[model samples]
Target: MDRNSLIMSLPFRTSSPPLNWSSADCCNWEGIACDPRVAYNNLTNITGAIKILMRCKFLSVVLIGENFFHETIPSDDSIAHSNGFRNVQHLSIIGCHLTGQIPMWLSNLKKLKILRLNHNRITGSIPGWFSTLPRLKHLALTHNHFSGEFPKELCALPALISAQALENDTNTSILPLFSIFGRTIYQYNSVSSLWPGISLRNNSLGGKIPIEIGRLKLIRELDLSNNNFSGNIPSQMSELTNMERLDLSANRLSGEIPISLANLNFLAKFSVANNNLSGPIPSGTQLQTFSPLAYDGNAGLCGSPLPKECTHTVKSNKDKKTQDEKVGGHRIPWFQITVVLGFITGFWGVCSSLVLNCNWRNAYFQFLENLGDQLYVTMAVSWARLLRRLL
Candidate 1:
């Protein structure tokens, strides 16, 4: 393409703005480098529509970071109808302060592999069509204000759970290099090994974390922290055996921490702090290796890592129930014993008095004898009178 063609398609102004479109070679411009296969623009103060970017058929990677643009994600029909940009494999446009929801047109890039749109003002729910992308491996949407329910469709993606591809496979390809924090990344491949799993952190999004999250068995990082999400942490998340970093902090999550999470042997960085989580932290896991702050803000959480202790030293539900039974068994039945002792004392005292006192015993027998004699005399008198009358 001629310099004029490239200039017309350029949407943003770079540090070294092209002074004259008459320039024969784009390589001659400052802050711009071009290999036969790649074009790199070291840009800032960039403005205008980004739709023109989709016109490049050979463009496999579009990594634009910290560059100012017209704030359009290029979702309008004009760009969607364009025939070029069919080979985009890795697209990362981060920290550009771009506004508007993630565009629907991005779905047209059938070959898209890794997508990072974090640190932007993008709004709306994560699109369900994202699951349709067959090659999508990594997605990061942190620090956006996306407000809606967690996209259930995303958890069913098979590519995210597939075995990781070797980084060396992309060595022959031209990868974009960018700076993050204060350090410069040498190559995209070297840093992408930790391409965080579904980083939708720091948003207004609310709702229960779906149980389908556990289906990502091979995922490395899953961060959904700093949102209004409510409900118990899905026990199914324990199925992510390969997970390295898991952060669900600063949410409205409740209930006990899943013991299964403790089985994640590969876990390195983990946190569930500032949530409604309760019960003892699972024992015998790397979760306890984290500082107490990891479990802080959860009033119900207790254990070694946390300062508060459980009411009972229970290892499991069964152990707790057994302890309760033992406690109940040791209780004395004082009321029943008291009643039985009282009854026995009253009966024995009365009988012993009668036996020991001769006068009392004689009176009791004499009263029964006299009553029997009186009854016999009355019966005799009645019989005599009746016999006389008959004669």
Candidate 2:
């Protein structure tokens, strides 16, 4: 078989300068390299790629992106135990049509520095062992079907720089001491070379955001939007001094937003809309910089960003209720009161004229006297006429 036919048989394309199979050294081919060297193969079938990795050794990087490998990753222990990608440092299977939970064999690649399985249909709870990888730096599982609470172990990955699980089925309560389990896992300063970011948006996640997240002072972005999270925005979050973006919108959270959040000098994107939050919005340049939409849908929330004004201070329920009733009572129509007063005044005026004015009293009595006399005279005439007729 010719080299072109063999290359064509594989279910992927190669970029130019095309693979020069005619050359005696296959390593010189496009997307293939050797030196004491690195191999950069991309956009290939998963099963075939695995078959090659199984036989070959000394690979340092394997990138397989945007492929149609629609099969479950082999979970067989024997296959996992095989000598494939043992020396690999970076592995990416992003945008592949891979399904099922992460293969158990992945735990064997102890040298892996980056693992990206994002933008696939992979389901099931994320394995906790992923955090045990000592050299891992970037872990992305975004836009998948992963379920259950976020693994708290992820917070313990000392070398982890960036982790994302956005648009998944992840759910969990973030405890107060969630990542504060003894010694600090992150040793680097806020300006460390690694830009750590955590995204867990658009999921079924619930419970309060852990105050312990402030411990990740080096983290740049933290997103927990569109979930079932409740309670107040943690005041400890102000400790994320290096934070750039923070989103906690569309949740069941209540209580006034913490005034301490004004300390987030680096905060560029902040939102907590569509929540049960109330009270005067915390005042600061950072808080005031956001639009009204950022604080909308929260009827109890008031202040500058919104049109609703805050009046007298109210604490207890009784005071609030009484104030509300007083305001409502003041809204009654003056026209209604005027109509009632006019009716009472007209009635009293006419009655008082008859009682107090002698002319009006005499005139009223004279009419009554005339009416009684006419009735008596008519009765007498009728009796006389009846007697004459009988005679």
Candidate 3:
């Protein structure tokens, strides 16, 4: 088919009425635009793009995502016939159902800035060559079947500001295994405006999160939840001064939740639930304000935000008392028990004696009556004397 016929074959059509292909300038084609120097195509498929680029030679931006192109990416030799694809700055193929590995040919697009291949069936490791894109800023490879260790080199891209690789099969021993990123961390020191972040939630990653991660001072949001990580939270994370949100929940991590974490003043969201962690929850202003659910499932953790109180010493004291009582022959509390028993025995003994002796009871009453008369007489005499003195 000719280029015009091939364009019409795809699902998209011109918003304007049909036009004569022979008489009209192809630049005026709907869904296609060109200035004196550049061409822009919003195509449904890559086929039309190849045809257009071969003729126009000056295309810069390609927006072909959400087009339902379920085929594998074309080989480099097939797509790179001319230099037409080299100047592409922004390439978005999101949710396009594109399958197979990321084409190696992409390395040729040296001017690429934004590469978004999210929500597709693309498999295999993320090629390390992506780090070579000097101008790449946003790299999104989330929600795919890509498996392998996370490419640490991506951390060093001088221009990268954001990278999202969540919901994939990428397996790493731990987050701090930055054999590739160790150098990258130093490279990022001079660049100030970059507020880079990484999201690697819902994977099978295991191991201790390395302390070296603190070097990523520019990172703002980090998520490493729903994995098999085990160990203490690195106190070095306290150095992430710009951290805004951190989620490390649903892992096997154990140890005291680092008190140093309180230093992250900008931390807004924090969680370490469902881990083997123990100790007092950090009492930082931000940590104290988080929901109890953030620290739930960790039975050993305690403090204000959680209902579990930190009473290890109190518990130990009670245990010691029990053990002492057991070893000391279950000694009775004589002071308390004797006082109670003596009062009861003495009260009942006297009452019983008084009830049984009729003669003594009668004498006791008679004696009480006489004592009353004598006391009354004495009081009467005293009152009379006081009155005489007053007169």
Best by lDDT: 1
C-alpha RMSD in Å of predicted model 2 compared with the true structure: 18.1
lDDT of 2 by residue, 1-391 (tens): 2455436535565443364565643445556543221122333446544644444465555655566456675576766777676666657676666787788888887666556676677877767797667555556665667666656666555454333321131321121111111285533221122345666566566667766566665567676777677888889888877788888888889999888888899887888889999998886557878899889889999887889987766579977666655654675455788999999999999889999999998998899899999999999999999999999
Candidate 1 vs candidate 2: which has greater TM-score? 1
Score candidate 3 by lDDT: 0.64
Clashes of 2: 1
Pairs in clash, predicted candidate 1: none
Stretches > 4 Å off in candidate 1: 1-49, 164-187, 190-196, 313-391
Candidate 2 local accuracy as lDDT? 0.66
Against the correct fold, how does model 2 do in TM-score? 0.56
Model 3: per-residue lDDT, tens digit, 155-234? 55544433332113132111111111215552222112223555556555566787766765657767777767787889
Best by TM-score: 1
Q: Can you tell me which runs of candidate 2 are displaced by over 4 Å?
A: 1-9, 12-45, 51-61, 86-90, 111-113, 160-194, 311-391
TM-score of 3: 0.55
TM-score per candidate, chains pooled: 0.68, 0.56, 0.55
Error of 2 at 123 (Å): 1.9
Model 1 TM-score is 0.68
Alpha-carbon error at 327 in model 1, in Å?
A: 18
